[model samples]
Target chain A: MAKVAAELKYSAEHEWISTDGSGPSVVGVSAVAAEALGDIVYVDLPEVGSTVTAGETCGEIESTKSVSDLYSPVTGEVTEINDGAVGDPALINSDPYGAGWLFKVTVESEGPLLSAQEYAEVNGGEL
Target chain B: MTENYTALYEEHKKLGASFTDFGGWQMPLKYSSELAEHHAVRKAAGLFDLSHMGEVWVTGLEAGALLDYALVGKLSAIADGKAKYSLICNADGGVIDDLIVYRFGDEKYLVVPNAGNAPTVAVALAERAVAFNAKVEDASAITSLIAVQGPKAEAILLKLTAEAQHALVTDLKYYAFNELTVAGHDVILARTGYTGEDGFELFVPNDGAASLWASVAEAGAEFGIVPCGLASRDSLRLEAGMPLYGNELSLERSPFDAGLGGVVALKSKEGDFVGRAALEAVKEAGSQRKLVGLKGLGRRAGRGHYPVLKDGAVVGEVTSGQPSPTLGYPVAMAYVDVEHAELGTALDIDLRGKAEPFEVVALPFYKRQK
Candidate 1:
């Protein structure tokens, strides 16, 4: 089972949002998503200042197994992208929630998200 | 539907292996991280459960003659206790399966085929042997295969057998096999493997799989042996430039197209084998497509069925590809137009609509130190 942060919110597509309720929200694929994706080889992130829509493809994560689209969980203008994770995608597998964060966005609109418990249930207790 | 399991299925399950349906058999995809398992095989040692591969026995006074007619290679000429990689082809020259023929005795041989194509190869062999004095038998159900591959493979394998077998195992050259008793059970230990490393493949009865695996695992523990799965097996083979049956080889392409034309023994063989006429014609008229190795420039690895582009036009397709764990770069085997298959030819692979540049390099991206 993957450890889920209680304070973080998760999307159905497996992206997790850091819920500090502050200026910008950090987003990255959850630990459950990282384990499922295996060893991530490459990460493509949205450019800073680009607008993203919730539940839409904004970037991509390529693993040894296959390529997957990274869906944006909240609609907002991208403020910052993780250059470290982009250069070393394996960080997403090692520290999915911390240093592996994909991008940060200034809040504009949000969609329905799940609590840690709800997200755990959705993944069949895998998260 | 319930899928088939190998004799070591329960053991793999206990080891926390993730299962995948391969060739109708539920086999382990990985026991741990694929990258770790791959490195273990290259650096220390890795054990494999290869029971899913097919083993067919041919026995009779004319067994050698029968196989010569059934396969593309001249099997009868290979010395006893030696193995040769060959291809089973159809009358139309299309490859049915790539197999290894082991001449165990004067009147007996063991044919090992890919798991999925075992039944097909067995049936083809039986059909081809009808006129000869040989009997083909599908012994896959009662047999299991285990491989210990890496730099430390030989050292670990030598400890399991008696001192008498030690000399034979030490003197055993690559592609040679020795029949001996392992833990009081009969086994055929061969010096061969799909990985680009020194390894030994042990063929034993199904009942002996668990014991053999346990003993080998225990003996290999001091050498840091890890039980590997199919995922690493695939990446290792890809780096070795080996063609998988469904991916790089199929009924649609002949051995010539897959760069395996050397396996076709046209000059040495006396009688005409199946597909001889068509393969001869294929040799006379060069194959339209050729298999080549592609070295990916960036991190984006080209996957199977991805288009190989030249000058922004599709000229071929990748058959097997992945990020090489040892080489630290992506590599792929692709079938491209003959004109663009030369070494150092620049090519582009459209990976999900994004083009990644790569260069044609020599096959067997990694070769073991002799």
Candidate 2:
């Protein structure tokens, strides 16, 4: 019963991206990743001017049991991060695709991104 | 690694719970989401599978006297239908294991300890009992524990007993237990839990676990009782300011250093127990490092083993750190030097090399809004 957005492009690591001609598309953890990570406690978000590359570490996310790295789906300059999401990480559990988006990137390169369905094929089976 | 499964494992799978390997067992982490389940216990009720914890029965003519020499607390005062928490100590006065002693009768007792430390505790008790006359038996295989926690836990338990055509267990106190017939089997119902919520822990035979879980879940449905896992349980206990065995208190650190001196009975009417001399010495003098609560000023949480510094000098190490569920802010427990351990002492935790501001706060970050 988990939702996989058709329009969103996802990474094998579970980060999702939506490309736009304008600068800075929002990035967030996919639905599969949110369920896997359980209740998110704290999120380490990149600053406004920080530069991130494809497959690079953008920030970090903490659950009750462990801390995890947030991989960047595409390379670009960090534009803005979600302060509200950082305060209440539970918002990410509720809506990992909408206002719970992690950070916005300038999209420097057109990197390879998988569809939501593809990500589910890898992680959504037994778990 | 051993891959043991609980009787509730398949039941949890049917409920769509997230499972994780904990201490070599496939345990439920959460049913829906950890945050949601965490709040459910804070606001409503949550059930947990605590079968992984081990239980040992110590019963003999000298059971009372043997426990008196093996553990720190005086156990002779424990009457039937009562439970007391104490630390099993090493000869050097270090804590071997923290356990709850259940006084089944005047001459019998049951000690519940962590699963990982169960074997060690049994061996130590038996070795110490060589000077006395007692019998220590590991009864973990026959007992299965299920804890129902939260505000409405008692109501749900009452309904389950009535609906199952069984007699309800009344007159149970916060740390007391009694026998009851539920689901056509006699079960030991104890009014104790790790979560800071009001709840009960039921010990039933392994064969009746599946049906009893279903029966209780059905009864708890009306009260919005949610099935929680180890994840919510960990966060809830941390918010209550309780220390985990391996994380906060260990064999290396005495109970006196962990801010749990209130439980130590140094002024016993009789002579001392195993760790009496060293504990008395520490009590007269002071502990070098004291456990204190730290509140991070920002969203970035300090992970475990992060250095706690004062004026650019490493003065302490964080034993446990997590963004608290109730406070909605980063909270952690650390042992700092006596000079910097006082409440409200301003400190900084090094988050991977960057200094994050924090201040010492009192324990039990969140209490029931009395």
Candidate 3:
């Protein structure tokens, strides 16, 4: 099982959102979700200027066996994206919470979201 | 989903592996990242419990003759301690399943088939063997398979049994096997593997598999041996340019269409086999499309059934795709028009709605280092 940092916020879809407000909250797939998907090779993230609603699919993260939806954890404007994560998606598989951060988003209006433990309770299996 | 679980289900959880329900089994997909597990098999060694795969035994004098008529390959020529790769096809020459036939003796052979298609393959072999005097018995419940692969495989395998080092694992060549005693149990040790590495796939009785597993882990510790799962299994097999039965080769596509013409013995029509006429006709006419390898020029990876286009026109379909850990590039397998199947031929793949540039290349994308 992966160690979940309590400082970060989470969503029902198992995405982690860290809102230190350096610019926008850095969003990434949770370690639980990344492990489930296997070795990620490709990440499809929205453009920096794109606006997305919470619960909407922003892009996709594809692994060797399947492709899964990368949902927006909060309604926001895309501020920055992780190019390294895009180039080698397995970075997400290795360190999903840290360097494997997918993109950053400026929280639009504090839409639907959950704390790390709350999200863990919803979809948490063995891990 | 209430999927069937493996004997090592708890052990996998203890290892902190990611789980995926494949077929009917809740199997471990990987212990770490797919790339990491894949690299382990190429660089060191990876352990795999392939107990889900089915095994059947054919006994009696007619077993050889029966298998000779049931499969595309000649079973009569297979000597003891040897194995052959074969396919059981439909009357239309479509593959039912790809299997390994182990000639255990003159009148006995063990047929191993894909787990999902075990029942189907067994039924076909039994139906075809009635006239040739063979009996097919599903031995899946009695046997367990463990595929231990990569460069350090032989060294690790040599430690399983004190006697195995000198007689079985060390001296056996590729495709050759030996019947030996392990932990006081009779077993078939084969120098065969799916990862295109120097490895062995051991067939042990069901009861002793757990002991064998624990002992192998203990034996392989120094070589950086890691227990691998189905996730790396797929990537490793893909790197070896091997095809999955459902994805690359299927009932909808004939062997000719899947670039498996090399295995079809059309010239040796001495014995009547399934789909002989259809395979012969296919051989004469030539395949319209052939399975080939495709490498993307950029980061885009083409996945299974995605369309491959040429000049905005669909010319082929991608059968499998992944960023190869060994090659450090996106590689895929596709069935394209034979004219465009040559290496270095430029092509395009449909990335959702957009067209991405790709090129036909020779497989496999990664080769094991000796």
Instruction: RMSD for all candidates, in order, please.
Output: 1.5, 2.9, 2.4
lDDT of 3 by residue, B1-370 (tens): 3466656667678888878767667777888666677888898998888887889999898888888788888877888889998888888888999999999888999999987788789889888877876789998867788888989988887766676346666789888898886545567888888887889888888778877877777888899889898878887888789999888888877788887776776665487789888888877888889999998898777888899998999999999887777777778999999999999999999988879899998888777656
For candidate 3, the per-residue lDDT at A112 reads 70
Ranking by lDDT: 1, 2, 3
Off by over 4 Å in 3: A1-4, A19-23, A83-91, A125-127, B1-4, B163-165
**Please, what is the whole-model Cα lDDT of each candidate in the order they appear?**
0.92, 0.83, 0.83
- Write down the DockQ of candidate 1: 0.68
Interface RMSD after interface superposition, model 1: 1.1
| Per-residue accuracy of model 2 over B1-370 as CA lDDT, tens digit each | 6777887888999999878887667899888878778899988899888887778889898898988888988887788889998898787778888889999986789899886787789899888889777999988767788988989888887776755333445567888988887656578888898888888898887888888888878888888888998888988988888888888888888888998787777777275578888888777888899988899887667767899999999999998888887887888999999899988999999987789899999998778763
The candidate 1 chain A region of ten consecutive residues with least summed lDDT is A1-10
After superposing candidate 1 on the true structure, give the runs of residues whose Cα lies further than 4 Å from its correct spot. Answer: A1-3
Each prediction's TM-score against the native?
A: 0.97, 0.91, 0.93
Q: Judge candidate 3 at residue B265 and give its lDDT.
A: 65
lDDT by residue for model 1 (B136-235), tens: 9999989999999999998998888899888878899999999887766689999999998999999999998999999999999999999999999999
Question: Which one wins by DockQ: 1 or 3?
Answer: 1
Model number with the top TM-score: 1
Colliding pairs, model 1: none
